[model samples]
Target: MKYANNIAAIDELSASEGVFTTAQAQRLGISRNALSHACKVGRLERVAHGAYRLSGAPSSETDELAAIWKLTASTAFSWERQAKWDGVAVGGSTAAWLLGIGDFHLSPYRIYAPERINSKIESARFGVRNVDEGDMAWMGGLPVTRAERTLADLCLDCEDPSLVEGAFRDAAAQGLIDSTKLGSLLDELGESKRRAALLEPLARALSASDQKGQS
Candidate 1:
């Protein structure tokens, strides 16, 4: 409850965002009652059931995001596991990052899990959606659309076309996806005139890269 004690606990929790339950507080030489009292007095704030945050640390946002992801994955209501069960992948943007295709900067952290996974769970947690028909593939124990699928997803969802272009260019340059595959995906999507137009140039760029490799 004391200022110094609260500060020390903040440092400990910052190092590891495990919930500082009453039992853990006892080991820190602080009574459970004292910990509860500190929380009551505004020295700490409970973000989740037992997860506490210091009033001064604004960096809790990232920790909270990570915690939400873990919590969602652990629950029976999770779409992530369902995606696995349905033989769908959980990648695209998230997979692209794993594949070293591009930087992970797109919004909502796109996930390409199975179409059967609960849309509610996806919307509630990571804002996930189905992988477009063309670019679906498996990677790293999860089903994900290919790099081209990832680029197309970004193009559809991103507000900034330039950002999508940048990711497409980076993936193309790295040879992370196939040009013909990307084109096939675009044609399969069949509804997004804007997206098809945007991707056309990037797909050509990838084609050029492939031709250069053959030569």
Candidate 2:
């Protein structure tokens, strides 16, 4: 019964996804000593500092998200504790997808942090950057850049304007981005005209949408 309970404890610590952290074991009513013993017995695998995986858990890209959740935020895996997850925000192409405003799938998952994090990861490539946190929000249980911030950053720093424009259209059509908020963000960022120019096509589409609604 005790061993069965330990298994149940491990299941809870992993959030049923089979990934957890050393710090989380204690919080889950399992001692660090027990975790170490589990590791020795091949029940757990240390994936990185304070991060672990069930020995035969299904593999997926989300495992990296689990590791990051450990590093940036507290180990508590409840919605109530998510308030403390201000340390990281998903960014770049990854944010575009997570925000539900783009279809493009690019490599090297990107995350914006208050500061750069040097860490090892498996199953995904990570591009962590210390960047401005103007438009930070949560999507699909992950802290990620808001649509306006994601599109603006793409327009400002990325080499491909066409891709950025497509993402802009998708976000605007879905009402995922607020033009007024985007404008204000650009004003604060400076070079407002230049950046706004990048979104001209989206503006035209919105104008057309407005006219159709009126008609």
Which candidate comes out best when scored by TM-score?
A: 2
Model 1 scores worst on lDDT over the 10 consecutive residues at 70-79
Q: What is the C-alpha RMSD of each candidate to the true structure, in Å?
A: 8.6, 4.7
Q: For candidate 2, lDDT tens digit of each residue in 1-215?
A: 26678888997766653567776776767777787888999988877667788888776655666566555554666364455555566677777877666665633566666566665645344445444545776544666778887776665545266677778778878888776777666565545677567655444544665577679
TM-scores, each model vs. reference: 0.47, 0.67
Model 1: residues >4 Å from true position, as ranges? 1-92, 112-129, 132-140, 192-215
CA lDDT for candidate 1:
0.54
Query: Residue 215 lDDT in model 1?
Result: 100
Candidate 1 lDDT, 96-212, residue by residue in tens? 565566566322444544343343433222434555444565442234557787776655555345555666778767777677777777677645677566566555655666788
